[model samples]
Target: MCARSSLIAVIAALACTLPAAAQEPVKIGALLSISGPFASPSKDMLDGMQLALDHRDNKMGGRAATLILRDDQAKPELAVEAANRLIRGDRVDFITGAGLSNIMMAVYRPITSTETFLIGTNSGPAPVAGKDCSPYFISASWQNDQPAEVMGEYLTKKGVDDVFILAPNYQAGKDLLAGFKRTFKGKISGEVYTPLSQTDFSAEISRVRAANPKAVFVFYPGAWGVQWVKQYSQAGLQKKIPLYSSFTLDEVSIQAIGDASLGMFATAHWVGDINNPTNAKFVKDFRAKYGRAPSAYAAQGYDSIQLIGAAADALKGDLSDKNKIKAALREAKYSSVRGPYSYNTNNFPIQDFYLTNVEKRGDELVLNTVSKAVEKAKDVYAAECPMK
Candidate 1:
């Protein structure tokens, strides 16, 4: 009789503890380059993520949700250290945000090797989308090469035969230029890889003028982009060369570049003017909250949080089962700001790309979607990914 009574008491105690454990806050850690070159886009990304969380009332599947942010200062070493602290110290269930490809590459293994899910908000390097792909890693943004690929195709269709290309000498830079060459079957006037720390591009501009390609394509992000665009304009090459780029003329950079961004063309997965109910709400609320239009990076950050929330909701907030969480994430049923979002074989996004031109809408300049460049585009690296 005493044994039976003790068993019943133990079972009852276990039941009471289970409910409390299930109700524990879902902890999400974000490792971002909140300072350094990527600061503006990173801030936009964070604000978007926060807006998504706010929409959920800071809860996921009836349980409280908490976000812990860490700045990586745009350095690989710093990103790794912060990722380790977030995983080992804070014990975050999800790890998101790495504003640069180098930062993402540095922290990918550390976060994904553990049970924590690494939903990258920005920066999808080639390795992560290819042979190095992990089931634990998912990209809420895009492959690094995708936007460049879109521009390459767009320019090819437009019959621009001779082009000069330039980018920073880094992993993403190499990937982007490679992607452009993959689709752009044209005479290359010149290809230049500049130093990542290069703030001055007068020499490169001089070289572009010497080559005098029919058009110029470049990939320079963040402050680097602002400097390059300003230099390109100041050099009087913007009109002559028909400057085209990827990830170079975003909302954040355009604000800094001001008039220089006008008439420039770029490719992106999401622009401010994408016509969708989800995007409309996102833009409206984001403008209300942040008092400025959100960038592509911001849209990606918003999607990452929404993806996590959708998975958590599917599992009813019980994140103890890693496999179930991964499966739920793979489903990807949430309404995306970028319409029709889903994972490719490698867990990278398979979505549409847009060709955008900067135009003035009233007093502010914005990227208006000129046309759909590619419908339901898949990254070139997906074939190399072992995962189905």
Candidate 2:
């Protein structure tokens, strides 16, 4: 059988089994953009979640943990609708997995109003990590700005000043630029906000070239990242200037940009280069099953399910007891794939960051860690958060 079909069969077979008759089934909602630009990462995350579910013997805390999945199609309105459906129709105990920040924000009000706990699978916009943070909302991912903070610090330490910032003119984009600016501590040549769907970056490239910044930072993810990196390379600026970003480059983007993505720098929490026992099993199993290397997004998605299973175990698999589950999650004693991670006051991740490079690992494109964990890479708004 083909890889996709094989994967589907595996997940479908896993989905069919019952854990035990004793424990209540816990419903967890997953909203991912399965048919749009984020399809790859979204699928990557789903695959990870599936792997974790499989590893847990398809149960959480001895209870059968069921996933209520909806494809948002990368649209905010669709995401809101899906979230509402998950909450009202499916009656899920908790909601999780959003690939885009706009989608996450769209679901926020409804989720918060309904008093449901929403755990972020990915999207880490500033407000959700700051002023809009809620007691029930937990961002399993880092704050929107946290990963970029490492990039900023790296650039600063390298004495690279006079940098140009580029980001989509959206909330997350602004948050990314804000993050880079927060710790950069140098002369920002300019900050250019481009339209989210603006395809041609020729004008922006010309402007950036005119500014002659030492380095250029951008935060375009998925297809946008692919196009931007390709255009940046075509503009002949790759050899002339340094390009640094967080989400702008990754395994998926590397596949999109092909040889053009070589040598680009990105910062991430997890990289495939992590040669640890926990990650080794994950990497081996993923490769053996799919014949392709998994991305960090997949790693995180898988870890979230594993963490959920740990919570279930702690709660003794009582899926109906929401309070116990919440307490178990808060205790955060799980052996995470990204090492041990605990929730911050805002429920965002408090973990390490590694400077990664997009490179070929055998026949696969993977993020290789050049730097070890920059211990306790905290978000800048931690001090600003009222929770403390």
RMSD of each: 3.4, 7.9
Runs in model 1 lying further than 4 Å from the true structure: 1-15
Top lDDT prediction, candidate number: 1
Pairs with backbone N, CA or C atoms under 3 Å apart (clashes), candidate 1: none
Q: Provide the lowest-lDDT 10-residue window in model 2.
A: 15-24
The lDDT of model 2 is: 0.80
TM-score to true structure, per model:
0.95, 0.90
TM-score of 2: 0.90
Model 1 whole-model lDDT (C-alpha atoms): 0.91
Give one digit per residue, the lDDT tens place, for model 1 in 50-88.
999998899987789999999999989999999999999
Off by over 4 Å in 2: 1-24, 384-388
TM-score of 1: 0.95
